[model samples]
Target: MERTGGETLLSLTIMSEYSETSSTETFSTFTGLGATSGKLIKRVGTVVVNGVDAILIRRRLNQLEATLGVWSYSTTDSEYVKSLYNDLLELSRPVYKPPIRLRALRLIMGRIEMMRFEDLATAVANWPISYSYGLLKTMILCFRDTLPLIDMSVGIERTEALVAYHYTGSHRAQKPEHCAAFLSWLGLTTSLSTPVFSRVLLQLDILSFVTEIYPTDDHLLRPSAIRFPRQRLLNALLIGLEPVNDAVLINQVHRIRTIFVWARFLNPPI
Candidate 1:
């Protein structure tokens, strides 16, 4: 069906690839506020989103960004800054491509430029943190053919980061060991398997930090392209690091299973 407003129509064709649901519960609550969700509803221009119908969705996206920015701005009157931030990420499932997607990110940045969460600087502050995610995202984009998210970032640290980690090997040219090269290039890896308690969405905290990161949910891991020893590439996070308790190890195993499921979903032939 088509969900339209004025001249544009939103394609409801978003399937499992584009799970039209927020990955976070709090994010959904914020987006559900209707018009209070901000300016993610307007189309800045002809944003060529691949999966969903590009008409109404673009406008909705713009409104979403505006709403998030306004809500999260420290001085903004809205009392839901944290609530809205979570919502924006939750609504990020149908995240757009560069120039287009950049619009929303800029809005988020504008709102939170002066803010820091949990006393830790923003993820956008450091490139290693962001690049690791970006590199992961790039590989995901390759798998999904989703969208180009190569915008390095802005600031001195980002500049230093780009210089140090701008590019290294033949990760893109399909050379031998590209997968190994890429993962090794990433240095320390973070888990993206599932959400943890208390911390909500910590990216890389191992001690008492609950995050749902790992290869399972991340569509761009390129599991097929990565051909290392099963225990090394597949269970790198667990095996590479110093051995932990059996309970934590068991949790990691469960998350790995999630990755296998998604990989199979992406490439059924495997």
Candidate 2:
């Protein structure tokens, strides 16, 4: 069937959109049947592909947003959540512009914030260590956009669990890269003036805090080789500790001092 160029182009465009939508549906099926059945199916085809040809990407994002909106916190499925996390991570990669990538990240954090506390912990615990770390890095990169999406009103237990799961490796052995990323995330989150941020800091176990700071090896300990901001970390801790009582504040300060003193002695220049 010979056709004009415009007609051919239009046909190809329609086919591309259909293919991309089909791919998304196929991906969803492997994650779980009926996980995205009702409202999700309705929202799947609404995003119009523009000149950017980001139809698939935008469709995936829309699907995730819709899923999260309809997601059941009480009967949450860990594998289903993990699949969503994986998709959000893929969308947050460099292939997308900062806006799109950050939006994906924001959604990732939003999903974390939206989960029931127990489900949040279990889901994070079951996730691959690398996947958890990737999620941490996404939050770090989109600090401002993602931080407030976390519902601090969920109370200290959930907030601490969220931090511990991603940052401290509550379910797995901690990696240097994970620790580095955690500090970056903590540094940013603690910079806020709210007392809730302070309370979140206090909820952390001193052991996890020390482990992150203790410098696992020479690469991490070297003065010139430190990967995270030492002074800023100290400042964040101080800012966070400000709202605590004198006795508790004193204890935290002393604990922080022990690590920093050792760090400074090892790296005398700082």
Candidate 3:
């Protein structure tokens, strides 16, 4: 039977709609499996893609850097930062080539440059610290064979300071093993400058003090603790050690030393 012209057009429209929807879903599913995989496959599928892998990786890395930088500097949008970091996990998937992995490492390091340690510590305090650490460790391991390709001192310093700050703010018992491992890593790297070492040491001391006060069961910094005068003393210990060469700092250091001696004698341990 010959179909009417109107009926034939209607059938064609319906088929077109179905085809469009199906194609959209198929593409979405392919990408949803993993951005890394989808991107790599697309590049490999073409003979003239022209460094498509580097292009895509660089784009994602730039985005990740900007997202984290804004999150750090803005001091808001913890949820948004959390989602972005979560989404970025796609790049770390195992299927990517070594060069791709290397780019991922470089991106990770790039992102670290924008980190505000205090802000990030508070932002992810309640979330699992292991997730952040694991991602960092993965990037570090990926670049292990090509260590000469990147300068890791900056990243390592930032990671140590961040880990120390995060643990201190977390109000949990300081993990000695974790601290030791960080120290070991630092030793393996080029020696940190005096100021950097001093700052990290102070952070570690703060971590120890925090653990002592709150112990393992408590996970929140109490207002009473913050208001305590000892906290000020601890703050003085850290901030006063900055490499500023000023008479005020000299006096402040002298003052802190004097106060420490008197406090030690006056508040002798029971």
On TM-score, the leading prediction is 2
By lDDT, is 1 or 2 better? 2
lDDT of 2 at 149: 38
Candidate 2 lDDT tens digits, 1-270: 123222222436445545554556554542323223322322322233243235445655676666754445333676766566555555544434555565565554544433322333334444444444544444433222233536655333234334434432322433443344345445554564344444444454433454554453434435432445444555666765655464575466567656666765675652
lDDT of each residue in 1-270, candidate 1, tens digit only: 322233332333333213433233244334443332232222312233444434334545565556544433343434455444433432332234444444434443333222322211222222233333532343322212112334334333232222222233233433223334333222222222211210111222321111122243333444543433222333534443334434565466457545566666876552
Q: lDDT by residue for model 3 over 1-270, one digit each (tens)?
A: 123222212334334533454355454322222244234333332122224334544555565655553434343566545544443444433334434444344433334332333323233223333333444344233222233334475454333334323432321323432232222232222122233333433333433333343333222223333323333433444454554644444454455445544654665544
What ranges in model 2 sit over 4 Å off? 1-174, 216-227, 243-247, 266-270
Among all windows of 10 consecutive residues in model 3, the one with the lowest summed lDDT is 184-193
TM-score of each: 0.28, 0.35, 0.28
Q: Evaluate model 1: give its TM-score.
A: 0.28
Measured by lDDT, the strongest candidate is 2
What TM-score number comes out for model 2?
Answer: 0.35
Of candidate 2, the 10-residue stretch with the lowest lDDT total is 37-46
Per-candidate Cα lDDT values, in order, are 0.35, 0.46, 0.38
Task: State residue 218's C-alpha deviation in candidate 3, in Å.
Answer: 31
Tell me the number of clashing residue pairs for each predicted model. 28, 0, 0
Candidate 1: where are CA atoms >4 Å away?
A: 1-53, 70-83, 90-95, 116-270
